[model samples]
Target: VSPKGARAASAGMFITLAAHVAAMAPGTNIGAAHPVSVGIAKMDKVMGDKVVNDMAAYARSLALERGRNADWAERAVRQSVSIHAAEAHRLKVVDLLAEDLPELLQKVHNLPVKLNKQTVILKTQGVPVHIMEEGLRTRILKHIADPNIAFILMLIGLAGLYFELAHPGVVLPGVVGALSLLLAFYAFQTLPVNFVGLLLIILAFVFFILEIYVTSYGLLTLGGVISLLMGSLMLYRTGDPGMAVAWSVLIPAVLIITLFFVGIGVLILHSQMRRSMSGVSGLIGERGEAYTDLNPEGKVFVHGEYWQAVSEEPVAKGEQVEVLKVEGLKIFVRKAS
Candidate 1:
């Protein structure tokens, strides 16, 4: 053991101490509970002192309750004390120091245990201890707690919904989006998420929509990209590395999502730039024949139909012409070259 002891979470320490109280035996050992050993930093002076004092009291109570060494427990918190199992047995913290659980159980057979309001005796000469595999739900929950998986699920949900919006009436996208979102929300509930970060991500989507409606010269899209990047960076604020969304996942996701918006924007712009493909406006470049003479006003045959016509130049009857433009049942024409 290092002279510098290890840290532990205070709440977990207290709970384990209670478990120690229930399972007290001459062979069992109760070690120190020092948060510093596990890398918990000392907080603000006021909060720090209170935390230490409270932890000390809880450990002290558990020690005394089990008739172990309370003084050593307090020293573990206040002075960062630690002791080996043999040393703990000498200090009345443990008894029957066998290396294996079976050996320990054999030695502690017929020993008395104090339950909340009952006394129990151990009897294990031939009894077997069964170990069960984790259930399906437990496995699922474990995977869902992973930040990378959660982040991926959220991206899938957002993409699915965007595709659904772009190509409406597609049942598959909506169904996939709804399922992915439900799973993502479940994962988020278990993760340490910052709501402000989440809101920024949603705001990014709003900016993306504005890029379609408001012509801000791509300013809105730039803002959306910045917001998305910031949000991805701030998604999980916990200091634990395992709880954080990995840079590998964050960087690629941000890039891909930005590309998604950019692609959508380009498609929208292309659609707007295209010439009209339906209705009377679709006849802008059709060749036709003058049905009657026009002193710049006459009828013309176009697209296999005769219709009202006007021209910038005069046309003799039956002269060939080309449509200059279509204006609400009127075809403006010019003499075909």
Candidate 2:
């Protein structure tokens, strides 16, 4: 059995326990089939204790069924100990262990086995080996479980949603974000996720958005950055070392997220200080020519558009004037000095 830790580890351990005759390859591991509670603040320790007890019981039962030393198996479960194939076979933890699957199968072929209290003879001397293939869902779930892929999907989803919010009329980003979120959720369903950590991540995004809306003297932005880092760190909590996110992924993700938010924050700040470039407000400070004499009201041509105009000073036709304010269907203008 190749049980490590987490969901697959538990399932693999259960499968191994169900086998009539079990043999492990050299250097193979077989312990720690327990779920780690993630994200739950209150019940984590309780869940850990329950899982340990349950796994220990299961290991003891399996050891007893296989006619192996139950005490050692129980101890292994309790202490999360894994032994080498040679040691396991010598200690009777496994039977007929071999360096490879073919050798193990050869040794087990035509051997007498007891399963579910029934004795049966294996007709496996010349039988063909059958291998099970993973289904589509399993394959996809495996891909999603990859830390790098999940991280990338998260970034893409966030970026898409941000783009959609910034430009409401664009439907692509919304669609992409929705799909990405669904994928991310599916991945999370199979992986051990900390909801509290996820909430912190969402809170970080909220803070970033608030920074854009309200100039907070960088306080919100700084808090947002810290929250984002902590959330990313807590995203996955598998007890197994192999399943955890690699430092390569974490370092790059942190750098990328930091740069992305910093760039966005700077852009937002710049936008806040920028003058309007669209709408009637845009017309202010723009010079125009009076098409007709303006005592208080007349017509002016600006940017290829004719507009009703008014001025405090008299302006002759074809005189250059600057727009001061816009009123209902008319513009207030001042003669160019």
Root-mean-square deviation of every model: 7.2, 4.0
Candidate 1 global TM-score: 0.65
lDDT of 1 by residue, 119-224 (tens): 8987877788886999999999889768788778877887788779878999798789878878888888766676767778878878987898788999999999
TM-score of each: 0.65, 0.79
Q: Which ten residues in a row have the lowest lDDT in candidate 1?
A: 1-10
The residue-by-residue lDDT of candidate 2 on 112-224, one tens digit each, is 99967788988766678798999998898899867667756776787779879988989999889878877777666666677766788788878877887786888988898
Compute the lDDT for candidate 1. Answer: 0.72
> Each prediction's Cα lDDT score?
0.72, 0.75
User: Candidate 1 regions off by >4 Å?
Assistant: 1-130, 162-168, 239-241, 289-298, 314-320
Q: Top model by lDDT, which number?
A: 2
| Candidate 1 clash pair list | 6-37, 7-35, 7-36, 7-37, 7-38, 8-35, 26-95, 27-95
Which residue pairs in candidate 2 collide?
none
